[model samples]
Target chain A: MITFSKQQLKIPKLQRPVYLVTAGQSKFDRAFPDKRTEELCIDSFTMAAQLLEISPAELKTYIHSCYYGHFADHFGDQLLGESVIHDRLGLDPLGNIGVKTGGATGGSTIWEGMKAVASGYSDCVLVMGWERMDEVPTDEGNFLISCAADKDWESPLGHIYTGYYAVMAQRYWQIFGKSEDSFRRTLAEISVKHHGYARFNPYAQAPMDITVDDVLNSPVVAYPLRALDCCLMSVGAACTILCDEDTAVKLTKNSKNKPLRLWTSAGTHTLRPADRMDMDIPLLPNETADQYKDLGERFPGGDRYPGFTGFLAARVAAHYAYGMAGITDPTEDLDVVELHDAFTISDVQTYEDIGIRPYGEGRTYVESGDCYHTNPNTGQPGKLPSNISGGLIGCMHSVGATGIMQTFEIASHIWNRWEEFHGDENIWNKFNRQKPKDWTNLQVVGAKRGMAISHAGVGSHVTSTILMDPDHLINKDA
Target chain B: MSMFGQVFVKNNQYKLKGDFHHMTPNMPIRNADDEWKLLGVTNPRAMTYMHSYGGEAVFFESLSQGKLMASRCDNSDCNITGTIYMPFRIHCPDCLAKNSVFDLTDIAKKSATIHTFMECQRSGAFNLLDKPIKFINIEFDGVATILMSYLVVGTPKFGMKVVPIFKTTGPTYTILDLAWVEEGTKEEQLPEGFSF
Candidate 1:
């Protein structure tokens, strides 16, 4: 398994074009004591139907099958939770299956649905994901999250998942970061940016208008990572419907939306990061071997591939996705992205992994003002805005629902309905959250293409979901 | 008298003893508002799992005997033969051949160095490690993969020379039975139940 064969490295191709017609999400919060998971799911499905300008029952008629993504049965204390949800959603006497790939469950669910539509097995498939973390307290929730790790090897250490990621942050800090004060500040700036963006997102769980000072002063969960740097433990549901070209066109005929092409490609590495072997960097289309030849010389202790400083799975996923979508460079080809920012430091790592920035220089992506809604340097739009939905850090890390939530965020931008969904006074009132006076529209103008990267523990599983306007594809046949 | 759950394998079948689960009544969770209307209930239960280490059981069992066992991929037909795995792989990843187990204690003591490390301030429920656990990933001279363990004494930095310490007195038969500390430390300075 050290060296990949040509068969294993082949770029995936869909048999027929697949499209994401519509998507929706429920209000995300750390806990939802008043509502059950099924109720939240119904809310998301109802919203999806509303987007299509159809009744929930009318939309249900188009769903030939269902793919449910509920990561932790332990958290819900229910076995076959997918069936329970399927029954509650009233989609019975139809084929349905469950998908679980840790935090990537949502993306993986959509991936399953995409394949179903691509192969013509189902014309339209319902991809719904939800998580109920409210049932357990904080420490117990952390315990359950830690169970995703190698039970015998890593889980026995402290039963804390943060400790597992903290080791990587420490390595990336000293090596790539050079343990500099500016680099630490750059990490804090990410927290400041995400939390600032959250104030505009009605569904975001931890909205704040905090400064870099506040993030730096926040209580340290681990050195180099503060509480503000971590993603939220949330409860919510999100969903998207995928269909073949015919079904997509029909579904969006009357609605103001258009069918967007969706291509999902996935990759995985060792569950235990310790087992990740040193390998050649799986270069993206935009990268060349000469660029990383001196990586070790520049950073010192940075040449180790898939080392604690990097995520091989993310790099592999991006490699497949870029190839499938004909993206030579993500910075140019893709307008926006929603990366799995489990930690602020991991967010920076993903920038390099996904080729938004070169290795040992992920800070440049933030420093250059390319990842913001608007460049702080100039009043112009940022070249590549990421996590406009506040991402997992400021938004919600509702595990199963997170990737679907991210898809909803990016799809809304492509649909040019960002202000409609996020800035609507009705939604703010429904959630009982007061909209900020200075709420800004984060819609990426002329966004023809976007992507959402869903990831699991320590680079174990990752999927890249690329959505593009059918009229504008880098590879026409794609 | 109530006893905790325990199990053992006999003739390829698990034999259980004592109570496997303890159940408690569900308590109503009533809202303080709206005249204390019932919202939900809390379900409380205590359970223990009988986990089998399988082929890697030797690695856990050896910790109590003051030995570190590593597996060698001896599949001659494999691409990466003779590669040693420190976390004790039961089978060779390249060829799926059963790995040959060998004592890695001496090499670990003489050549182990910290590859990366972290000091964690928080832990989840049911964790046995003390607060501020000094987590360290160790690299050996010839091992292919790093081994994640904890430093029992002294702060950890990159490439700090260390040796493994075993909880030989009262072993938990788990990874916690093995720990690490700086080299040249006195035997008397070791933690209770742990020794060089």
Candidate 2:
């Protein structure tokens, strides 16, 4: 495995900190046969322009470069999507590049856009991502996604993408020693929670009031993985406008949309699963054991596997992102999160992998109702309430669009735009599972620091990004 | 108005009413597809290409000769001289130096212990030969990388000792030239030993 020691990969101190001025996304759906991929990108780009309070033409003039994150050129006819979006938007042809990191494409593309502006290569860069998987047959789409795996060794050996995660889930079960009944319950609860959250999202693809029993009753696609445990193959797109600190201040001078400072972003990767033998149960070094006591307590209790978990890339990425943002404890430091949950197992594993909870105890966090939109006891959302936009589970999985949509959700929550845009009607409360009387919105009150983690390749590639309210980052003691 | 603004600008409350209402499953729109298809047009073809396996040929050539093989960087002045590669490498990945072609041709014994195994039910190549196809990652005694191949045994347990059973017929030049059977269980007998 690739080592991400502090001495080897130091926390980056940027000369020019980047900021997200505004972002937007089209409503996700199961199929968009009427619209092409380029049209979907244009739709998202137009929404972003409207939110920025600029005409499409005005927004075009400001963007010096563009990066389009698109997966599955095989599924669609839009291979030159960057050029297509640029030409369609009437933007000047400065430079256009396509970013493809499988499902991590959105996160990687946004990071690239930020780098372009941060390095003084451009003043403003437009980052957009999309996928149109529902246009093809579901089995064909599965084959396309399987192309991301090791083709010669894996794909030819009857190892589908879902089978890869199922193997990991089985391994996790072996290490944790959870009974089949308990393990099934844990997986079911995760699906039920995401579904509950999705009911509030108007744009969500499958937002029914699903129960734990419903998830349990769902057909098993693979051993230990039910159909409900997986994300939908939806069609959608998302875009973000990133600029330097000075440009952000200028853009948001008289607007309700406040700039969320891009505190730091980092990524780490290892392509193959077998290369990481120690991924199932990694031991925390003794020097940092005391610091991670809470996580240590969350250990599921096994003879430690004497190696790292497959989530090493995510840990390394999150560590770097948090380290540069000067956040030592993510549980206390982060206010909200939008993580990749392509599977129920991924959702649970991400909590531990990114230090939201301790390893092997993500089920505990879910069972405790910490991930609830509004806590039963406090009548408010918990600290770091996840998937407020219903995540990929509820919001739907549109491949390239998912990561950028995660970024947009956190930024919109930070801006607190729901009330301003939708007014104080509380339109979402009626759809809530409990339908609490005083619950207002999914946005965390007084939320300052938010993090977005996106990954792909059965946890081989990961990008962790930390965003903070500019005022809060400079004066943390307050 | 642009096509987008015209669609969404009517109001954000559009989905809650009119033609775009998102109903729950088992509602009015259950599994509906509104498509315009042109009938009688058949697109039947196949895509074929020759994949250059580069340095992997050294391993496969030995496999065709009824032997397993392992290769490593053997440049004396290079950084990773003894680092072994499973599928073979043309150059030393670490030092990026041209390796000795003959040094990568070492004969490997056909015995390894299973590191991990999975019973996969689907193959993208449409080649599922068994009810539940079993693939194993086996660790050769002296090799650094685990070799991935099919295990033709029933319910493989982790760390089970295995040996290769080569296909004397069919496409014998490829890595699919052999499937593994559990060690000491004979369905087919072989010569006691062979010269390298």
How well does chain B match by TM-score in each candidate? 0.97, 0.65
**TM per candidate:** 0.99, 0.81
State fnat for each of the candidate structures.
Answer: 0.78, 0.22
Q: Mind giving the per-residue lDDT tens digits that candidate 1 earns over A374-444?
A: 99988799999999999999999999999999999989999999999999999999999999999899999
Per residue, candidate 2 scores C-alpha lDDT tens digits across A1-478 of: 2223457556666667788988877767887645666677877888787887877677777788988888778766447766776677677557889988887888888888878987899988898898888645677677777878776555555536776666566556555526457766877877887776676565567776788889988876655677888888889899999998677877767567888887535555545564443223332221255443553344442323322234776776776676677776777777888888888878877887777777656667676767766665577677667887778788878888888988888887778774443223333332223333443456667777788888887776688877788887833421
Model 1's CAPRI class? Answer: high
Question: What local distance difference test score does each model get?
Answer: 0.92, 0.67
* Highest TM-score model number: 1
Q: Cα deviation in Å at residue A243, candidate 2?
A: 0.8
**Where in model 1 is the C-alpha error above 4 Å?**
none
